[model samples]
Target chain A: MSMPALLDLYRVQARMAVQQQLQYRMRNAMVLVGFLTEPVVYLAVWTAVAKENGGSVGGWTSGTLAAYFIVWTLVRSMNVVFTPYGFEWRIRTGQMSASLLRPRHPVHYDLAYFAGSKVVWFVMWLPIAAALALLFRPTLRPEAVEVLVFVVAIVGAYLIRSLLQWLIGMVTFWTTRVGALFEIYMVAELMLSGRLVPMSLMPSWVRDVAGWLPFKWTFGFPIEVLVGDLGTRALLLGLATQAAWIAATAGLLALAWRGAVRRYSAVGN
Target chain B: MRALRLIALHLRVVAMYEMQYRMNFFLQLFQSALATGTGLVVLALVYAQVDELRGWSRPELLVVLGVFTIIGGVLESVVKPNLVRFMEEVADGRLDFVLAKPVDAQLLISIRAVRFWQAVDVLVGAVVLGVGASRLTPRPGALAVLGFAAGLLFAVVILYSFLLILATSAFWFVRVDSFVETFDGVFQAGRWPIGIYPGWLRTGLTVVVPVGFAVTVPAELLTDRSGWVTLAAEAALAAALAGLARLCWRLGLRRYGGASA
Candidate 1:
């Protein structure tokens, strides 16, 4: 597809997603509320710990901790891509056959659909963010450049997660054990990606390991852009790293799609 | 007694069905260990920074973690599967079959399904609890054990009532699939002692969700921090919640427009 045609496809798919998602706003709101509890738990724990430790632990005061997790809620919502389980379902139900018949890549459709849903999620997230801010009193103040970096970084985080998860989803073509593998991936992300806590709070070895992996770029980097006081040079470096992960994962996904498609023997009607 | 027999019958069928997928038990073990390991590491990190967490020493906090796992295991293995099934049935209008059963509809619905593999978490939790108890300078005595047993009984009752009340909401709204996820997220708070939270959230966890009562109160009994008065209060709360749940279930039943009706 030409560039304009591809853009049009994304526009149409995203519009459709927004329409479909809006119909179930109540359901989505419940899920969003469910998402809120995680950060609240984390915030409450870390704040208590920080307070007990003479008002700081590993350079994270209670206010900054609040900002990190509150921003975590948004970054998490931004990076909610299509999961590997969905891929397993699509192939088992022969939905892949319908998708393959399309002229464009199937990933584009998913990318657009989830992007559209993010629009609705962002709207829903506003009231939630406000409530958290009021309760936790998160101390978030970003410069103009940091604000610019955050916007680019979140988009980068979204693309990187989407492509990597799509690559993981492609594994369903070979085996049905993707659930176990996905759980493993999630644990690694939880520990290494700064999802559970800030990297500063983690041991140095964990921080060093996280630097090499793509998980940090998806979660910790984008969140730190707005939450932490990273220097301008470090912020640019993080964005560059996010771009590199996006490129590498997209390239790997393109290769994996070839093998996955060839291996696919469509199942359900 | 009839409820016990019904649960036993369901367990037998679940066991036979699960025996075919024996490898899944190993998978569950691995996942449960991974989760438990992560919890321990977080505790390590927390304790590394301070001697105690708002009067909760590391080992005392470990007891809380263990109780959290055990309660979570019970919920996932029995309560959650049934609750999800109930919600799905409500949404699809298949609940008529359940309501027509010979046994009490509430009892039947609550005991219908079990994920046998998920019970691995209970074993994992017991092992953690044993290790935590062993580390205490003065180990827990028989009185502590008795209190723990009673606390656990009340905890399960309260947790089950909470799940039933949540499931009963399906009768009115018909779709609350995300309720399980929300519950899981909120339940994570029980990993820490309820005392660590602010006054308002602590009260919310205690009364609104009762996660504090379900996990922390039991752990406190094991650690000799709570007395019989607390246990008696919990017992009363459990009875009241059970009554409330029954009332809610009956009221919801009146709203159930069955598929065939």
Candidate 2:
């Protein structure tokens, strides 16, 4: 298919996904609330930490930390990927057959669903973010160039993290017990992606490792850009690294998709 | 007494089912380790930057985390699995079978599904507590041990009552799963000392949510800061909550029987 055609298909799929999510408003709201809790708690923790440490730690004052976390919440919300736990159930329960019969690839449906769901959640976050900004009185001063760069980086980070997690979810095709693997990945991301704490405060070696991995680019780099920590050189480097990981993971996902489809013996008719 | 034996038997059956999936044991271990590790590393990273957080040293915070994990383990192993199933049963009318049993219906439903694998969380929590204790300057004495035990019991009572109250709401609000999810979200705030939060948040966590009384108060007892009056207050609050939960459960059961009509 031509690039424009594929783009149009994606847009249509996204619209459908959004509508489906709207049908389950209560469930979507609950999930959105669940997603908001983590970032807010971290915001509170770091804000307290910064306040206690003479009002600044690692170039983040309490206000700056609040701004960073508020933005972090929005960025992270948009990037929420459904874990593969449900995928295994789909295969076991014969839902995969229905997906295979669809006109578009199942991944396109998922992508559409993700896009639609985030639109709903992003609306929910705006008021919460505004309330936080008012209460916390965060200091946010970003140049127009920095704002543009941060937006681009945020989109890149979302795609990279989603593709990486989608690849991980693909493991359900091979193993029924991927729960442990998923938990391990979550813990690692919680640590390395600056979900629990900013990478700035981690031990030097830990920060170095985070920089080398795709996880940091997923969360840390985007937040750092918003906070004005990433210089021109680092911004370019971060974007390059994000692109590289996206390409690599996209390739791996395609390969895994082919293998999983070939090995697909439907369970329990 | 016979009811206790029946519950024990039920637990044994569930234990056997869990043991059959040997890989589940490993999964439990991995999950507990990673969860505990993430909390510890976050604490470590924070302390590395600042010597003290709201006057909580690294080891003191570790003790708080240890207690948090231990209480969380107890909730998951005993309370959560059963309460979740009980909620579903109430929704689907399957609870009739449970109610018709010779045993106490509440007791049967509350302890029905035992996830024995969750004991791994308890074991890991104990290890963390041990490691945290080793790093303390003055070792906790017999009195401290006694206080810790009492405090832990009090915390468990609070958690059990909280879950019971939340689960009983299922009878009224059949779609009360989101209530449990909200509770879970609120409980995550307990990972740190409640004192560190702003005054408004501290009040919310302590009275409204009871997150601090579940984990932090017990840790304080072990570390020799908690007074007898505070412990007594927490114990009393737990008892009140439990009593309230029992009353609510009775009321819910009556409604299920169409008694209001």
Candidate 3:
């Protein structure tokens, strides 16, 4: 009822969620290792390409490319959301019914779980990233202003990507084969978000379409911010676009949750 | 003869089950189109900045991409999903039923769960290979085709052994899904020619991970550039790995008291 009581409940939930995540330390470590490999491999490939192309391609020097992808690794991992497991398991086992019966909205619990789990992953991943930075000798210019903007963008990107993926996972309420859809989404993210390659290297039309989509803001824009590639106007525009997507996706998630709950209740899952 | 009949029956059952979901066929087609489009676009983007990467031209790299997709399709459609389930079954003790069957348990378990929708990837890969080969210098010859087929078979065997070893770990570890995910992540590096990477990475892909043999060596064969010794080594490695995987599976089953004799 009161704000303080609500905050207390959130705190308690967060602690429990964090404890649950810590129980699977080995699995978490393996996943973090797996996550780190992607960015590292891409960094190597792009570095070679840059070398072969006379030390820079698309305005990024070898060192900047290294910095971009290394930051990309850490930022992307921080924004990683595991909504499918919770969504699918809840739907399959009728745990969602109990959640719906709770006093608070179900998303509160999910958000708490997401935040707590990311806390665990972040602790484990930061050192790995630091080690990579040292080994690769990435030339990083840690601008204080850019760092602040990057932090904000990272938080914004996490919210937007998580909400969107959660909404997609909600489709499990309708179909049993959501895994395929999830895979397709991952492939799209790998391309559009500059996870596979930098957006500047892609065709101009492809870049335009990717920029129009929310996926770019999730990884590409933030990495650009960290790399000092985004000018003043572009940085502001990126933040604005991220905010717009967060709002739009949050609204869609609400509508989808309402419909999904109706389906579950009426059809008796 | 009876094993052939059982395999046929399994195929029929899988086909009947999959045919009910016509939407899946279209969904897989869309997904494969997106995947192929993204790979090609990335390659085009990379080549836009450079004339050659480690002496491989654009068309040569495209050929590599084609083989990678084709091998990936075969693995997903025939080997991966089934062996993944087989690993789960091994954990749950249901693999005993498979072992008790009259047919060869390995063959049965390996081919039992085909997602026929993955045929789209195979078809798309064929088209990509066709286009890529057409763009190659001197064109592909009969020897190249034979080498490509042989290299493909060798690649499939290597991939199968890699997966089996990973899945067989479930017999001991009981939680190998993460290992599979790690494999998937590492395998993404195969999209490029392995020669482009540094020495350590090249060695890891060839000897440790075996992704190079699965995708790159075959592509090299298709381009008619790889030496006979490379093909021979790849085949030898595949055979050795497959034999080792079989031995591990047998030992793992022994631990569960599923030994036949």
Candidate 4:
């Protein structure tokens, strides 16, 4: 597709998603609030630990930890994507066969739809963020360059996570019993992606491992861009890393997609 | 007595059905272990920073994790599957068939399904609790063991009632999976001692959601940090919530308009 056509396709799909999701404001609000618990729980635990350690642990003070987690809620909202579990249903129910008929790849639909919903979630996130700021009193002040980098990084984070999870989801083309595999993936992500805690608290080896993996780019790096003290060199390097991950995952996904579509057999027809 | 038999019969059928998928047992076990491992790593990180959290030592906090896992197991294996289906039935108006059953409607809905393999966490949690207890200066005495058992039972009741109340709201809204999702998120907070939370959150976990009561109180009882008075209060709270849940179910049923006419 031409660039203009692809942009138009995204625009249409995103608009559709926004319209559909706005019908369920209450439901969306509940889910948004649900997303708050994980970060809030992590924040409280780390803050307590920071306090007990006499004002700092792994260089994150309580106030800065507050900033990290509060920003965490926003980054989390941004990174939501089509779950791999949905693949089981799609393939088993012949939904994948229908998607295969489309001129454009099915991933575009998911990318656009979720991207549109982020607008709603971001709007919903504001009041909650304001309320959290009041309660936690995060010491978050970002430079203009850092703020600009963060905006770009969050979008990068979304693409990296989406492409990677989509690649994992494609494994359903071979076997339906992918639950255990998905669980293992999630566990690794939770550990390495800075979902549970900052990577700083992790041992040096884990940090080294995370640096090699794409997990930290999707979560820790983006949050740190706004909240942590990253030097100019590190900031630019992190963005480059995110771009590299996006390209790598997208390439792998393209390779996997061809094999998956060939392996697919429609169930009812 | 009849309800007990009905529950046992339903569980047997579910067990037989699940037995056909034997590999899922190992898969479930592997997933549960991974989750437990992640939790233990979090504990290690926390303890790496401090010796205790709000006076609860590392070993004591391990007990809290065990209780959280066990309660989580019960919720996932039994309570959640049934209530989620109940919500869908309410939404689609298929609940009339349930109402037509001879047994008590509430009991019927609550015991209709169970994930036999998911119950692995109960055993896993017991082993973890035992390990945590073994590390103590002195093992929990018989009295403490009894108190823990009693507290855990009451905790289950409180948790069941809390979910039941949420499920019952489907009668009014016609769908409440969002609330269930929120509950799942909130329940994760119980993995730590409630004392560590800020005052408002602590109250929310205790009063609004009851996860603190469902996980922490039992853990505290086992560790001897709570006494009979706490257990008594827990029992009273469970009974009151059970009563409230029953009332909500009755009220919700009256509002239900079946699809079939």
Evaluate residue B245 in candidate 3 and report its C-alpha lDDT on the 0 to 100 scale. 93
Best-performing candidate as measured by lDDT: 4
lDDT by residue for model 2 over B71-138, one digit each (tens)?
88988898888899988888888888887778778788778887898989999998898888888768
| Residue A114, candidate 2: C-alpha displacement in angstroms | 0.4
Interface Cα RMSD for all candidates? 1.2, 1.7, 2.0, 0.9
Report lDDT (CA) for all predictions.
Answer: 0.89, 0.81, 0.82, 0.91
Ranking by DockQ: 4, 1, 2, 3
Estimate, for each residue in B68-137, the C-alpha lDDT of model 1 and write its tens digit.
8988899899889998998999888899998888999888888788999999999999888878878875
TM-score of each: 0.97, 0.94, 0.91, 0.98
Q: What TM-score would candidate 3 get against the native?
A: 0.91
The per-residue C-alpha lDDT of model 4 at residue A238 equals 94
- lDDT measured at residue A142 in model 1 versus the true structure, 0 to 100: 88
Local accuracy of candidate 1 as per-residue lDDT tens digits, A120-144: 9999999898988888887889888
Query: What's the CA error at residue B108 for candidate 2, in Å?
Result: 1.3
Residue B45 accuracy (lDDT) in model 1: 86
Candidate 4 pairs with clashing backbones: none
- Once superposed on the true structure, which residue ranges of model 4 sit more than 4 Å away at CA? none
Q: Score the docking of each candidate (DockQ).
A: 0.76, 0.54, 0.50, 0.87
